[model samples]
Target: MVFQFDDLKKKTILLFISAPLVGAGIGFSFMFFAIKNQPTLGETPWRTYLNIGASDESMLQKAIRTRVGIYALPKEEVIYFMASTDSDGELLTSDQRYEVSGIAPATKIWSITLYDKDFFLSDNALNRHHFNASSLNVEQGKPFSFVVSSTPEVGNWLPAPQKGNFALCYRFYLPPASAFPINESSLPKIKKL
Candidate 1:
């Protein structure tokens, strides 16, 4: 086939514009899926722990972490356990009620905060957003338990958006040495009711 100079220029221009658009689409798709499906570093069946390493994170891992809002903090100083689903492996929605139960162990402090699917605090009638060890009224030698739901509940209620998926961030500040190498037993169980 014979090609004219004018035709070739038009094709080149089309290639230049479309190539970036295609590349960008693919890049965005990859990033979205990568972050969405990325496995947690130290994951149990109910909860997942993010291993914010001091160094040696790949570019894709870093991108995923950034997208998920994993911030800078020394592992020894604090540990984070996150859950977006119930023990039944169902995505957590405010339509159902959930219970999170576990002993705090001997940590300096611990807290559980509720966040919407977008990782922002949800707006609700109750201004309450989080509950910490200090704020909770725990009887000595008794395990701690809390309810997560859109409806009001007795005792340690963590509010959730009335009509969307939500997540829980369990933070242990200045955790003890035994808290390292977390396992299912060490983490709280989140069960849907």
Candidate 2:
């Protein structure tokens, strides 16, 4: 049998159509896994703290941020710290009690917000979802500490959901110029109790 020009044209058309679909599928899979496995700045297997740059984010970083649905302010305007685990490297669960302690960096205002594993505000009974610097009970210019648990706690308590894993989002608004170049050392420490 002899090959015909019609067969060549049909194959070429099929290639043109199927190539993009295959490429798109592979590209999407790669992006999904890339974003899933990408490590944050101060990340261990259990804890992750995202460190976003001011104006120097890579394309992959920007895509990951977008995928996570984070509308981060310019680094000069705000800084963020995120954690989903405790110092002992355990996933933060509603049944476990945790404590976070640190001084608010020299910023105009700071807040700690709680979110469920899906990044929605945890449905807490106290109707409280966050604690800000203005709401904290500071002692003589000393560092602040707060407890996170399903139970009620006294003094700077952040309520965790009744069930499932949760995360914390710490934000500093209008931070001083000196607050730039943040690192894990400057953030609070979370420990399970």
Candidate 3:
């Protein structure tokens, strides 16, 4: 035995069921788009989220910043640039070898850290994932370089995951105002070799 509802009751039921579903779909898409095309400020391969950790940041920007595990510092104090590709715009993967060379600007400190696709340190035997001002072969005001590979390298080996993709984050502490829109060439050059 089946009983059908009147038009008004049926409309109410439909709204109840569809409202949440529609809202959920809209919300998920909004977040996904925001996170995927996340507003950043830079050229290809290396970009920094706009207003990340800034007082005037939108909620979405703050959320993206937190998701990426960046330490909150006003842009005036610190800035970060992330790259997931080589110089020729190739997606950086674990299987390839790369030579990363750069000269740090006159900041309090700087570092280059490697992260897996999940935005965490790549797992490797050396337990090494980054090289910073204090941990490089070159001195301040000089060019520094390193290698990113799954296999051990001669010097400055920032490990890569054995079987997945990865990214690199360059952080500058107490960077000067002129450092805005950090120059692409100024940042480490990741060349597939």
Best-fitting candidate, measured by TM-score?
1
**TM-score versus the correct structure, for each prediction:** 0.85, 0.78, 0.83
- Count: clashes, candidate 3: 0
Q: Estimate every model's Cα lDDT from 0 to 1.
A: 0.76, 0.74, 0.78
RMSD (CA, Å), candidate 1 to true, equals 2.6
Model 3, 58-81: lDDT tens per residue? 776665667765576767777777
Alpha carbon lDDT at 179, candidate 1 = 65
- The alpha-carbon deviation from the true structure for residue 33 of candidate 1, after best TM-score superposition, in angstroms, is 1.3
* Whole-model alpha-carbon lDDT for candidate 1: 0.76
As for TM-score, the candidate ahead, 1 or 2, is 1
Ranking by TM-score: 1, 3, 2
Q: In candidate 3, which residue pairs get closer than 3 Å at backbone N, Cα or C atoms, i.e. clash?
A: none
Candidate number with greatest lDDT: 3
Over 1-193, each residue of candidate 1 has an lDDT whose tens digit, in order, gives: 7759999899999999999999989978999987666554344434443556747877776776677756746668777667787766688898999988887656747788889999999887888888777777664235888899899998788888989899888887887777666655667778886
lDDT of 2 by residue, 161-188 (tens): 9899988888778777666565556677
Error of 2 at 12 (Å): 5.2
Superposed Cα deviation of residue 115, candidate 3 (Å)? 1.0
Candidate 1: list runs displaced more than 4 Å.
Answer: 40-53, 139-142
Q: Which stretches of candidate 3 lie over 4 Å from their true place?
A: 1-7, 38-44
Which ranges in model 2 have alpha carbons more than 4 Å from their true place?
A: 2-18, 40-56, 139-141
